[model samples]
Target: MAATAIPSYNPSPRVEPLVQYRPLHPTFGAEATADFATITPDLVDEIKRGLAKYGVLVFRKTGLDDARHVEMSHLFGDLDDVAPFVSGLGQKNRLSSDYLFDVGNVNPDGSVMQPGTMRDLLLKCNYHFHADSAFNPRRAGISLLLAHELPPAHLGGETEFADTRSAYEDLSPDRKEEIKDWVVLNSQLQCRRNANTDKDGILDPLLDTDEFDPMKHRFGKHRLIQLHDPSGRTNLYIAAHAHHVEGMPIEEGQRKLKELLDHAGQPQYTFKVQWKDPGDLVVWDNTCVLHRSVPGGYAGKYKRDLRRTTVHDMGPQAWGLNGVGATWRSGLD
Candidate 1:
């Protein structure tokens, strides 16, 4: 057989009549500095529903303290400790990474080699554009990224969340059937990039021995392409980690992956966070959202600081709350 041409994912032609969105309330333009007052009843309810529907919600300018940040996150569920894969330091403990997740923030190849070292890593707003936790079965229920410091660049600190619910609904029935039971290998890579940024060197960017077990480093890979078992929702989890689709050919597999990625990141389905000031907190659903920091920004200015709490649904081997350090099921270790 020759090969199948990659499918295009334009929904404009197949969908019903055109629809548009006007803001619910006069769409108050985002403010410069969001006030961090008490979490209102309306805010909580909207956050819950938005997390379920859009998989992400962006809060601009809410100046909350550490205690309140953790307390508010607790209402959602337990939080996970910052894994070695992330860059956490100082008071910001539970985040996936700490300090600034920006480009120059991480050391050469992307791992933070040491504490308090200025490797010129990228700003936190320069997010890498991927799902929060596709590796675990109980993926991160929601991500709370609060901006205390904005990138000095002043333009691209905003985050883009694709409407994953609609993304899943738009999939062709045939494409849906093709990946019914498939899974993908999920791993974290922060090191091993050659000067060219294309050379693949090792399994992960770093050993990740503290957060992830060196033995289970290669063993924890769950599946090749994920189907949301809990919600019967379809979302792609493959990122820099997914190398192949279990039984699919190398070239063929890559083609399908690219098509999915391109379709997922379309601007029409995404919302960007042009950060106005600190005190902004964003909560998002990991299962139904794909996020990325627009690269090519804040290459060397501004120190981005944000705190995050990872929440997972009840699982037999659920990850414990992120406190002094990360503690998980020894089996997973």
Candidate 2:
């Protein structure tokens, strides 16, 4: 197969480098510095190249409002809307646009969600490491998350990312070959159930009802190991949403999936980004890394108002094994 050709970008003499990157991790993450006001087609290409090299990029105090945030996301690719998921839960849109996902803990009325509530339980799933929209037929490509409002420091609203590409590179050759061609089943319901079980042992009523059965819900089928084309590296695509492996007994497949997830989640292969200011932004490629929101003292006390825009994956593996034209379907829908 021919490599996808990327057009060369040359910045003007005044701004020789469109963006500058400082490595956050030796292997994966980076802090990017760029002039937001000077955004151009050439600059967008440079940012995309940066993302290809560093799976995650942090931009400090971007100072973008909801409108600008959405506008910036368009520079990457087609955006995925949160309306389906929002409406599936029988709730009205909270953000100004469906393109912006309200990942914060605040409700439509601007009140923090109380602990043990259905919404709270559902949000708990964010604590687990997973790629955005992996449960969908077309997985997410690049995700731009901005901190609109943040809790006080040390309250633990930080976001953490796992470097699956590096983790895969470090794996024993035998282990890599063993799972290279394996297919895994990913489901949003399974992720929610696991999050609830791990946190408070609170059985979500929805999970108990037939309407929300994990087994019955639509599962996104993808290879366990895949080539992250942009970086030309093979990465483990496992996540908390990965319910089980295909062509194996349920229990056996689950245990195998857990083993891989545990290996990839080791501290050495992870980086935590602490939200500093309200306007801080983090951009990550979901095709190569797994990310999760860190829970802390800010849980039910303070509001962590974060909004995200997910770009639909345009890579060759975007559809995985699912049929073309398949859309995001949540169990709640």
TM-scores for all candidates?
0.63, 0.93
The lDDT per prediction is 0.48, 0.88
The runs of at least 3 residues in candidate 1 whose Cα sits more than 4 Å from the true structure, single-residue gaps closed, are: 1-36, 39-46, 83-127, 153-155, 190-196, 199-216, 219-240, 249-255, 314-333
Candidate 2, run of 10 with poorest lDDT: 198-207
What lDDT tens digits, residue by residue, belong to model 2 across residues 1-333? 999899999876673587899999988899999878755778778888999999999999877889888887898888999777677767877889999988889988999978898888888889988999888888899999999889998889899999999989999999988998899988988888887773666666655666656787789999989999998999899889998888889889998899988998999999999999988989999989999999999888999999999999988999999988886575743
Give the alpha carbon lDDT tens digit for every residue of 40-148 in model 1.
5445554565444445555655667566776677677666554443433322233333322222233344333342232322132124446655444344666677666
Off by over 4 Å in 2: 1-14, 198-202
- CA shift at 6, candidate 1, in angstroms? 76
